[model samples]
Target: MFPYRPMRGLDEGLYCVDGSFGRSPLGRRMTVLVLPSGRLAVHSAIRMEQADMAALDRLGPVGAIIVPNTLHKADAPWYAGRYPDATVLAPRKAVARLARRMRIDGTLEDDWPAELAAALDRLALGGVRMPEAAFCHRATRTLILTDLVFNLGVQFAGLSRLLLKLDDAYGRFGPTRLFRWVVLRNKAALLASLRELEQWDYDRIVMSHGDIVETGGKQLMRGAFASLGL
Candidate 1:
């Protein structure tokens, strides 16, 4: 289990757990946000050992567990078994698939509790064939995204680095060309989602696959998505 690193600031009631994805040496991050009610909201959970779970227990009770997309549920079942009372939420497209692996309490399209809604709001990404949800933390001016934008940069090596570079993925704050080609289905919907993101007034971005964008995030995101020529 990796250690959870807390971000600074009251509004930034977030912590990150870093680990590698599958056989890939590139790091992946899971976000944990402490809600206003003193309960924790965990996103893209990565399985943790008993000692690490004890560490998280020191922060607060787990209230919500989120699997943001279809590909990110590797640890959901573990979390669900650990926190039976916590709400398990996933995108509509992923519920059926995830249900086959573990239990899902609801989809993001359903209504949210006021306490949960007050701290974070979920937006459905309109462009892709596969469903994905983006979250914004109102008080923190932070946007949480999964797979929408990657910043793998130079951390990769050998063939992975070479492949990411060939895909226009390495050393960047935008979506790789290969990602766009394989995952993107509707340019207009994606552009609309980008326009909606501009209105969130986000100053920072927390990405699942890369470095967090700490400043000027709105403009950077707009410019990044614009590379699609949508």
Candidate 2:
């Protein structure tokens, strides 16, 4: 397992594990949701040590594994191999790509388990080269994202910090300029999706690649996309 922090609670029935992102110190995170039925849903999974896995198992039986997008599918197979009974899920558009990495049992749009559906709201981002999905955990009003934005802060050092600074995402809560230039295909469509997300009642934002926005996330999101006139 790569260097990682042990599982820690984030909100009521919500948890996260922080770990290294490949060789970069930019970091990554895995969000864990304990459903109303006591089953666990893992989003953007990361390979963890046995102790951490045991800690996660103590929360509840792993019922679902969510690969939020193609870019975040690297660790999906690891989770699948560990929890063979867990249903692997991805966005409808991401299923085909994710299937090349692991067996995708269903899409988040239609095949999400009924028992787990009530705890969160889901959306598929539009007009991006790599299809991605976002979620809002209803009970905590936390918006969950993967690569939509980054908030690396000052934890990084040396080369990683320099690279992030070059990317214009080192110490901010916004999308990287690189992402805008490379991944985003249609600004209008992405802006439309961002507008739709504004309707969600979320105050906190938890993203895969950086620090969590504890409050005022809506305003931050708006400001982040203001350049695109959101």
Worst 10 residues of 2 by lDDT: 19-28
User: How many pairs of residues collide in each model?
Assistant: 1, 0
Best by TM-score: 2
Check candidate 2 and list the clashing pairs: none
> How do the residues 76-126 of candidate 2 rate in per-residue lDDT, one tens digit apiece?
898999899999989998888778868899998888788777898888998
Q: Which ten residues in a row are the worst by lDDT in model 1?
A: 1-10
lDDT of 1 by residue, 11-109 (tens): 458787877776664567788888999999999998777777788888899999999998888888889999999999988877898889898999887
Give the best candidate by lDDT.
2
Q: Could you give the C-alpha RMSD of every candidate to the true structure, in order shown?
A: 2.2, 1.3
Q: Which regions in candidate 1 have their CA more than 4 angstroms from the true location?
A: 1-11, 228-230
